[model samples]
Target: MTTFTSFTFLLLPFVVFHVANAAIFDIRNNCPYTVWAGAVPGGGRQLNPGQSWSLNVPAGTKGARIWPRTKCNFDGSGRGRCETGDCNGRLQCQNYGMPPNTLAEYALNQFNNLDFFDISLVDGFNVPMEFSPTSGGCTRGIVCRADINGQCPNQLRAPGGCNNPCTVFKTDQYCCNSGSCGPTSFSKFFKDRCRDAYSYPKDDATSTFTCPGGTNYKVVFCP
Candidate 1:
């Protein structure tokens, strides 16, 4: 009985560690149309309207992003292109998707054992999105449900998405490559529509949000 108690005690920490560091991401498509959901470490999934996909993400994952690809055509082998958010023409994205896509960016178990997340339009906007925490008592959520696509500026309009000024001009002013930049008229256009989203590269002050570690998240398209 003593030996069994010792073994059980040793296992407790492992179970606690696993539960405290892992997160589940539920991605859903509420759009009237189909959406190809893309994630860096989670790969990709075809989500028809009302469909959903779940992903298990490990602790300490950084620079991770989730987004939706529209108007994609994949072959039997999962090789294809998307009108927006194409990641090297592969259904299972091995890298970040191309621009003109709304983004859900996150970092898990960072400083202070907190999870950081945000909805970003720095790459651009294609679909409406809502990113929220479903667990860990995190109540705040972010959303970008603007008509940016239909009202996209002429220079930034793409085939099936609204391109960011950086994609159209590629200048440091729009890209913030020099590490010193601020909002522009173009960034304001996006910020005005979606106040919760990161309209520019340095929009951290208001755009970024935090939750306690082990928080599960839900990302919904057209929410």
Candidate 2:
């Protein structure tokens, strides 16, 4: 009996390690229209209003992002372009999508066994989004629901989305290429609208959120 108890105790840490290294992402489209959802490691999916796609992401995944591609038209071979967030005209993205997109960025099981996440408008805003932890007792949720497209500045306005200043001007002020820049009027415009989102490259103080490792997450479009 004592030997069996010792074996169980030894197995417990392995189970915990496995659980801490994996997560399920529930991607949902609550918009009034259809959207092509894009993810770096998870590929892409077409989701109509109320539809959803679930993706299982492994632990230790870094620089992962999810976004919605608007006004997309893919053929039988899953090849097409999107008005925004187009990833090389492929339906299943092999890489990150183009800008004028609202981003849900995450790195799971990172420093101190925590999951770091944020909603970023640094690429620009194409859709309203809500990113939240659904499990692991994490109650923090970040959202970017402002009407950024309608209120986009003239220089940043695009056909179906708003462009970031960096995409427009490509200057160190907006792009932070020098890595020693601060907020500009353009970045402030986004920050004013979506206070909880990353307006520029260094908007980390209030924009970033953390959850316990292995926490499941939900990314809702038009939420």
C-alpha TM-score for every candidate = 0.92, 0.92
lDDT of 2 at 92: 96
Please give the lDDT score for candidate 2: 0.88
- What's the true lDDT of residue 130 in model 1? 98
Clashes of each: 0, 0
RMSD of each: 7.9, 7.6
Q: Candidate 2, residues 1-223: lDDT per residue as tens digits?
A: 0000101123367656764566899999999999999998899999999999999999778789999999999999999899999999999999988989999999876666677899988889899999999997999899888999999999999879999899899999888887777889999999999999999888888888889778999999999
Candidate 1 lDDT, tens digit per residue, 152-216? Answer: 99999999899999999999998888888999999999999999998988888889898976899
Worst 10 residues of 2 by lDDT: 1-10
Cα deviation at 47, candidate 1, in Å, is 0.4
Off by over 4 Å in 1: 1-20
Can you give the lDDT of residue 104 in candidate 1? 95
